[model samples]
Target: MGEATHGLIDGARHAFVSPGVHWLALLLLCSAYLQGAFDKLRDFGGAVAEMRRFGLAPAAPWAVAVIGLELAASGLILSGWHRWLGALMLAAFTVAANFMAGRFWTAPKAQRGPMTNTFFEHWGLAGGFMLVAWHDLGGHLGV
Candidate 1:
């Protein structure tokens, strides 16, 4: 490759694999869920009602558990301690929650589009969590 091309590639590689970049990526990945957790905390009663709307019996307990998991995942990921475990936890939770709440296939025709979109969005977030876990486990893109 040309010298200029080689320099560009090296710079890109450094930028991509830097610790700052990793942290920023994790922050972006976790931002939505963190907001969700905060929202649940801010509106405990509303969260319980929403959980009941989702058909989770014992809605109050389920709301507490969900908020707890979200907070735990955020702490583990932000602290970079056992981040892989946190990522896995979030990924599993995302999948279960998506299926539980985003039942697009069974929804009425009018709601299918939005519900399906949400379901896929959650899956994408799950994939992002898995990628974060892989990186934490020492996988890299030749950086």
Candidate 2:
């Protein structure tokens, strides 16, 4: 092939290759998304109970609202629509999880442990999600 032809081919190859990285990143994000979604549905009652355990029973409706937000955020991520909004929702989830952890820390000892660990794990997942959102939106949308 001529020099110009080779250059065109190389550019095309790189263009195709770069999006593979983005898809892999999205896959990692989707995996985490699925896990978080499952946790919300699987332990619906326990999550509600944990709110009471953590003395947020007065805000039980708020707890349910958070679950709805999780589902909505996951849906947005899946649809690839309004992704920045999804990122904001995930960030909110992070804050809520951390707040839950703090509440558990001060609760009666017997109601701590496993729940605390789960909440902290959720917090970590949120951090990973922040990176994904940064990659998807911050890099792309500049917001």
Judging by TM-score against the true structure, name the best candidate: 1
- Kindly give the stretch of ten consecutive residues in candidate 1 with the minimal lDDT sum: 17-26
RMSD of 1: 1.7
Q: For model 2, what is the alpha-carbon lDDT of residue 25?
A: 62
Candidate 2: Cα lDDT at 73: 84
Error of 1 at 30 (Å): 0.8
lDDT of 1 at 12: 93
Which residue pairs in model 2 clash with each other? none
lDDT of 1 by residue, 1-143 (tens): 99999999999998798888878888888888889999999999999999999999899999999999998997899899999999999999999999888999999999999999999999999999998899889999993
RMSD to truth, every model: 1.7, 6.8
Off by over 4 Å in 2: 1-24, 30-33, 58-60, 102-143
What digit string (tens of lDDT, one per residue) describes model 2 on residues 20-126?
76656655665665575578678877667766776775656755776777678877766678766776687776777678555677778997887688777777767
